[model samples]
Target: MIGVIGIIISLFLLMYLAYRGWSVILIAPVLACLAASFAIFDGGSFHMLATYTEKFMPALAGYIKAYFPMFLLGAVFGKVMDVSGSANAIAEFITTKIGKGKEIWAVVLSCAVITYGGVSLFVAAFAIYPIGAALFREADIPKRILPPAIALGAFTFTMTAIPGTPQIQNAIPMTFFGTDAFAAPILGIVAALIMLFGGMFWLTHVEKKAKAAGEGYGDHKNENLQIMDPQYLPSFVTSITPIIVVIVANFAFSKWILPSFDSSYLETDYDTSFKAVSGTWSLILALILGVALVILFNYKRFDKGVVECLKDGVQGSFLAVMNTASEVGYGNVIKTLAGFSLVAAGMLSISDNPLIGEAISSSVLAGITGSASGGLSIALATFSEQFIARASELGISPEVLHRVASVACGGLDTLPHNGAVITLLNVTGMTHKECYGNIGMCTVVIPAISCVAIIILGSMGIV
Candidate 1:
């Protein structure tokens, strides 16, 4: 249909322009209007301005209302960790424990530890890059490998496949599936292992090939960001405690504490059920506790002043959340179109197995949007009801569905235009041409393989 062509054309333009580095916040609304413009020819009452105001704006506002707390708290938590030196200390300790002559492994593990501990992916990269670059340079490894090494740790398994991870990508699924963060624990572990080891093996092989050809760390100037001052940083114990606090607090709250709260009056008092909000509540409280502990442990070490640190984080949170919300708004507009019905029907028909269709739909949308959280949010918003119904009819657990959908979005979402990928490249001062191949192997190809493996395992009732 002409409308489907228009939608596809709009999507192509979105990706193309985004790949050229235009801001999605600037383009998403414009593209939403473009996609909706075709509806006028379909013999329907479609007002472009009305759709933007009524449908798109409401969807955007709703996402902000529901998720702004997590985004704000997460950015603040990551910021405090950075300013107080906790993130640097943790990365240093990890790299030190991994020892000398294995710089790539050290960088990967250092990044993995901090990001899995709930540090934002961007913060993890900024915190670990100086250390990783130093290690790679000392070990005579190619500097270009550093970004991919960091990407392997920060962007793949820890962000998606790991159980109990507090990343927003993982948290987004909880509300949709009415499942907690630790969904499909056994299957999550399997996928995590596949991405971690599989990625490491590829990196190791790349290292060996480069060494055989005598490729050494090339000369490159350090980025202008503030370098970590070891003298003022807290000890490893003080630095790591906050991360542990977040992990333990998240687990206890999600598993025990929040559930014990009396919400029986919700039918009369609040419109929502307890299960609908418990997962988000757990992460929010855990992040708050983590931020409080980070300050408590390093109260005097905030070189930028606590107010300034908080301001920077608050600013960052607004930008990050707005970008994703705009994409969600674009999706909301797309869903209202006549063409989207065809796309949804095709997605649902991908497999008799709901898991396969779920995986493919989430991954493709994520790839199209070039954002994991945005695409995952949109997919769940659009197809969650169908997935839930199909899954229930087929005897599939919602927990498995949660795990699959979470991991599925992560793979294609890291394509070159991804915000995180661009930030990683900028942090390391590396070009996509110089290192994106490695990044693709680690974050994209490997994660996809892991996702496929988990899909098979889920289909086999292994979850």
Candidate 2:
């Protein structure tokens, strides 16, 4: 009981301190030890230093070992896209076609198109914001609506529910489930359509109410807006080709290319099998191809030069991976406690359906951690075996489990403390009071609905 209290207290503090802007990399280890202190008092055998060194460090290092390439390549890919003006070019192409009067749709679709193409939501938000701001300003739409519009596209479907998205949220389940990015394709598409249309409907409704209320783009200074000159931007075709390369190359590698290779040497040489690592290998190769293609297509357009862009990307990946790795380490420490058995049992009892249990655990942890990937990683690392076993017992596919967990993490992860939500609001120069409710409507409420829909579909044997 005392140990359980410690786990609860550590989680609350983790959420609160993170919300207060403490770095997880700092807070996680401290909190893991805090929880361990309670475990020690509760008569559990855990040494704080040993736990940190033996348990936490191993978990953190293992995650980095497995995933650092994807993070590094993904960051570099996003940086190249941003610096080369491909992201802006794509956004401009979309918004220009949609035109000004349809500001909400234009903004959402612009963010969505680029995000679905494998750009980071942060990159998508930054690249699209200037154009989206200009559009909202011209259309007399409330500036506050812009963040949710961007969130609906970048943070929800494309981030999670969509098939073949290279977002780490979708990719995280692969190692655990032995699934690829396109897991449970039918259910993925179904949930994606729901998130797309449902979020669009809600944002459009918000636009209507704002129009009726006569609230124009609120008075605010849009400083450093930096809308790229259209002629300076790459052509739409050149801009979109790398994105297509990522998608097509990822599919090819995961489906046909990697499987054809005789990875028999993997078990002999590395003491692991090809099946265990192929999904990650596919993503790494695909992102490399994507990054190489981006440079090839826009080599001359790199204003800061290719090396600088690559350097920035490599630097950027370190923090992103370390933050999630810390959370993973924190979770690994928590699982070693005597209290965790009760917690595990309680999580499992959330529903008779293993899918529901998986979804709830993923969603709750993500909300607590304020990170979709962090939450998903912790939930899966700790509970995936049990989820797999229960799912198998019920004749469920790990593919459906993969898809459900991926989609569910995206649902609650947009809580007000989320970094992406905070950054989106900051970049758009909007207050949380002004924008977060609508952002919630799109990223939180709508995605939750889609999650429920997919879980139901999966339970109905639609997978």
Candidate 3:
């Protein structure tokens, strides 16, 4: 009972600290240490803190080793794409091919492709902004529309609504649940469609309201719609090669190659097999492809100048990556202190129904973490033993429970203060008020609806 109360209080205080702008990395661990101290002191100085620190320090190091390489690879990929001009070239090509009249659609479509191709939100934003701005200027669209539209395109659909996207929001679940990208493909597809249509509907409605009041909402027009000189361009094929390489590698490895390799050569466990494919190997492949693409595409332009651009791009992403990586330490603290485990255990204690237990646990953790990936990791790590036990006890399939958890991950997990959301708002120079409507739509409304739908579908054995 004391353990449970301590867990609850610690989680609440962590959320408060997060809300107050304290780094989760700092707050979560500090709270965990305090909770552990109380737990140990009450038990009469068992040296639990020293034991925990010794074990946790190594575990934390392992997590950093496992996680940061992937981030560094992703960062390098983004940098290469940015420096090689592939990102901009793709954006420009889409706008030109789609024509100027459908500028909004063009921007949205470009953003979707980039995001779906596994570009990070930050990369997607920086890559698409200039193009979106230029398109809006050319099509007489308002500046205000560009930011929201770009954000909507990048975040709402591909980030969560698409399966196998490698967006941390989606891919992180795979890390925790041992579920494949295709586990809830249909759910993701349906959710994405709803969000896409819903966003477009709101965008059009806003445009109409603004125009009706004669405010000239889209009144600004720039006459510069022409494509720039060919010297600044890379071929369309060159620009899309990295995306193709990553997707094909992921698919082949997951579907045919890894499975075959595993069946004959390696372990039968899904988690172990997936780690081989999605972990260091995938990152290495991505980095090689990105480097190769940059060299191949810019062979003529390769000089000291190219090196400088690469350096600048890498330097720019370093701080952001480090900040995000540091937050992982907070997540580690929560996991180490058994805070998440206590919460999961508490939820499971109240319910015999596995689905209900999962939903409740997901909601609580998601609410606390304010990050889908973070919450999913917590649930996965903390609840694995319980999940296996419950599945056997309830005659439920572990796979089904895992899938349900993954699906719930998409909807209930991303709260208002998600790093991605904050970063998007910061980059666009839009306040939460200007974009929270859309944010709420994606993070709250759609997730709520989708969670219920997934739960029902799973309950019915339809999924």
Candidate 4:
């Protein structure tokens, strides 16, 4: 009971600090240390610390190994795309295709393509902002529309809407359900369609209404808004090479490399095999591909630009990557205290209702972590096994619960301090007042619709 209290208190404190504008990476470890100290002083021991270190260190290391390379590779690719002018080339192509009168639709489609193509959310914001802003200026659309439209178009759907996306949020539940990406394709597709249509309709309505009221993101006229030159264009194929490499590598590793490695001498289960292949090797290959593209595409004219770009990319990525790493480390600390697990057990013990159980778990963790991915990770880590057991007992397909958890992961997860959201805000030079409506639309509205769809589908055994 005391342990559960410690967990709740720690979670609430973390959330408060996050709401107060502390980064999750900083807040998590500090809170974890505080939780550990409280547990220790309350009769836990140094042995408890040691146990936590043993368990969490490996998980943290694994997470770093798995994700860091992707970040580096992505950063390098984005930098290359920026310098080589592929982004502009693609933006131009999109603009030409959409023609002059439909700038809003062009912005939406551009964001969707870049996001679904696996660009980092921050990079997507920065890359698309100038284009969207320029487009809005030319089309007489309000500047206020650009931020939310870009955000919704880039983040809401494709993060989980497309099956086989390799999104961490989607992948986390697979750790427990033992299901593949295809397991809930129908659900993902349905959710994606709903988000896509809803986002487009809302943005269009807001634009027209704002225009009618003569109130739009405070008029700022600039002469360069309509220019769409391709003098600096780089090859489109070269620009997208890294995304292709990562996706293909992920698929190949899942299908062949890991299976062969496991079958030969290891004989591990699917999950273990997945972890092995999806971690260090996959990322290393991705980094190599990114580097190769930099060399092949720009080495002659740019000379040392590739090396400089690599350094800058890695350096720029550190804060965000470390933030995620620290969150993982904190989660490790919580696991060490067994505080989160105790809360889960207690919730189950008190209420046999799965809906109530899910609500209790998601609300606490989501509220605390201020990250959909982080909060859902905590919930899934704590309740996955129990959820499976309950599903099995009730003759429900465990896949349904797994899908429910996956869809639920997106709800209200973005903390004011979330690195991605903060990065987006910083890049766009927009405040919460200017942008929170859109974030709320994606993080709250879309997820609510998704949850309803999940419940309906899950209950019918269709997920």
Candidate 5:
């Protein structure tokens, strides 16, 4: 009983502190230890610190082993896009074609295109902000809306929506659910539409309201980062081809190429089956293709040095992967506690529908961990077996499970505590007080609503 109380305390603390901008690396273990103390004592085990090394480290190690390559490749690919001016060229082309009157939409779509193309969320914001800000200022929209506008594109549906995206949030579920990034293609598209149009409608409505009230981009010129001059940028066609390559190569490989191989070697364990690793292999290869093509296409533009970009990307990937791994460790510790059983059982009982249960579980953990990938790693690590069993019994497709979990992570994971949200606010020079509301609505509420809609449609066999 006391263990359960401790678990609740830990859950609330994790969410509140994470929202308060605590580092997940530090806060996660502390909270995990706090929760584990009650359970350890109740279970007549006094291995306080040992619980961390034994339970926590193993989980972290497992995730790192499975995902570090993808993180490294993804970071490098995004950085290459940033440094090569590919992402900017694409954004500029779209914004230029759309002209100036609809600057807000242009900014949103520009970020969306870059992000959906597999640029890191941070890189997308950093690269897009100058363009977005210039457009927003010219169109005289509120600067406060910039965060949400960028977020709506980069953080909301695209992170989880489009099939074959390289976002780690999308990739995390593939290992657990035995499905690929293109899981439940029709349902993913439907959810994508709901989030995309829903967020745009709200942003557009707010833009009109704020404009009528004379809300403007304000005088924040001092915060603007000096960016690349457009003259050196690659042509829009050359710039966008890498993104196209990734999407096409991923689809071709996953649909036709990989199955041609003798994948029977993957059947060593239920967890490492073909379904579980196919998504990982597909995305990894696709990202590698993205990196190769971007570098090859823009080989001359990299006079500043490709090696430097690789170093930066490698360092960034380590940080990104380690942070998520630490949170996974924290979650593993919590799961071993007696209190976690109650929480898990309650969440499991929320719905007989595995899709619904998986969504709720993934969303809650994401909210707690303040990271979409981190929370997702924890949820799947802890409850994937149960979910798979339930899914099998219910005759649900693993593809549905993959899509649902991915989308659900995009929900409450964008709460203010989220690292991506904080980084974006800093990058865009927006404050949480002034801009977080809009960011929350677009990235959190809209995605969540869309997630529920997908579940309903799936339940009715519509998707």
Candidate 6:
């Protein structure tokens, strides 16, 4: 009972502190240890220091070791895309084609494309936020809604619903379920469409209402978008080719190349197996190819040289990966407590259908953690074995489970404490009080509703 109370307290505490802008790296271990003390020692000495060092640190280190390569490559790829002006070029191309009256469509599609191609959410928002602002301004749309417009593309669908999206949220489930980024292709597509079209409808309605109320793009000074010089940008083909390279190469590697190689050497004394993680392996290759292409295609255009881009990317990956890794660590500690079994059992009892249980469990954790990948990683890492076994027992496909888990993780993760939401709001110079409502409608409400739809369709054996 005390242990269960600890888990409950820890989750809300973490959520509140994180929303207050505390670092998860610091908050996680402290709270994790506090939970451990209540569960592990009962009325005895809490041994807070020992629990922190023994349980929390190892989980953090282990996650870093397992996932560092993916993070590093992904960051560099996004950096190269941004630095080469490919991101901006592609964004402008989409909006230009869509034209001024359709600011929402242009920004949403542009952000979605870059994000689905594996760009960081921050980079996705940062890369095209100015364009979003300008388009909103030109179209006489409200500036306050820009974050959600940007989110509809980057946050809502591409992050989770799209099949083979190299987003970490998509990849995290693969290692656990022996699935891939393209898991449950039909289900993924359906969910993606629902999230995409459904979010579009809501935003379009909001834009119309705001427009009817006579709200124009407010007086926000957007230096990032304003300072971008058009002449130095890459052409459309050059801008999007790397994105294509990533997807094509990822498919080839995941479906053919990596599986052909023998990795029997990686299975001793570890719960992890390279055979199970081929999805991440493929994404690494995909990101690398994308990065190389960006550098190659834009060689002459690099203002600060490609080396600086590499450094920036490498530097950027550290905090992003560490933040998730620390959350994983905290979750790992939570599992060792007696309370977690009760928590897991309760969550698992949500439904006899494995997909329902998986989706609900993943979404709740993600909402609590305020991170998609972090929440997915923690849930899958801790309970994947159970999920897998149950799936097999119920004759449910792991691919379906994978798709459901990935999509569910994306839902509640956009809560105010979410890193991506916070960053997007800051980058666009809007407060949560101002724009978060729209952002939540697009990312949280719409995605959650989409996940439910997918689960229903999946339960009906719709592939």
Candidate 1 Cα deviation (angstroms), residue 425: 1.1
Question: Which of the two, 5 or 6, has more lDDT?
Answer: 6
| Tens digits of per-residue lDDT for model 2, 1-463 | 8999999999889988877789999999999999888976777666779989998999999899888888898899999999999999998998889875777888888888888888889999899999988888888888888888889889999999888999999899999999999889999999999988998888888888988988888788545788889999999999999999899999999999999989999988999877778888888889999999999999999887899999999999999899989988998898888887788889889788989999998998899788999889989988899889988888899889999999999989989888888888878888889988989988999889889998998988777
Q: Encode model 4's per-residue lDDT on 74-180: one tens digit a residue.
A: 56666665555555566667866898868877877777766555555666677777887777766777776676777676666766556555455555555567664
Cα lDDT computed for each candidate against the true fold: 0.89, 0.89, 0.62, 0.63, 0.85, 0.86
Taking all chains together, each candidate's TM-score versus the true structure is 0.97, 0.97, 0.78, 0.80, 0.95, 0.95
Clash numbers, per candidate: 0, 0, 0, 1, 0, 0
Q: Residue-wise lDDT of candidate 6 within 198-287, one digit each (tens)?
A: 888988898889778888777866445563677778998999999998988888888899989987766875556775878888988889
Model 3, span 1-463: residue lDDT tens: 4655665676678766765677765565566655565555345332446634654354445455655555555666677776666777888888889995777788888888777766666788877776776776656665566656776677666766566565555554455445545446666676677767776776667656765776442433442333345468788788888777776666565556655543433355443554434433543564556556666776665345766766765675555444443444445555555445655456888867676677666656666666665565556556766766766676665445655565566555446666666666666555676666656664556656655665666555554
For model 4, where is the 10-residue window of minimal lDDT? 262-271
* Candidates 2 and 3 compared by TM-score, better number: 2
After aligning candidate 3 to the native by TM-score, how far in Å is the CA of 40 from where it should be? 8.0
Model 1 scores a C-alpha lDDT of 0.89
Pick out the ten consecutive residues of candidate 5 with the lowest summed lDDT: 267-276
Candidate 1: tens digits of C-alpha lDDT, residues 1-463: 7889879999999998988889999999899899888877786666778988998899999899888998899899999999898989987887788898778888888888788778899999989998888778789999889999999999989899888888889999988998888889999999999998998899999999999998998877655646577777789999888888888998899899888888788667888888888889998998999999998888898877889999999999999999999999999999889999999889889788889888988898899899999999999999999889988997889999999999999999999988899888987899999999999999999999999999898888877
Query: In candidate 3, how many Å is residue 457 off?
Result: 2.9
Segments of candidate 2 deviating more than 4 angstroms: none
Residue 183, model 1: Cα distance from true site in angstroms = 1.2
Off by over 4 Å in 3: 1-28, 34-52, 55-59, 137-145, 175-177, 215-231, 262-287, 299-342, 349-356, 388-407, 412-414
Candidate with better lDDT, 1 vs 3:
1
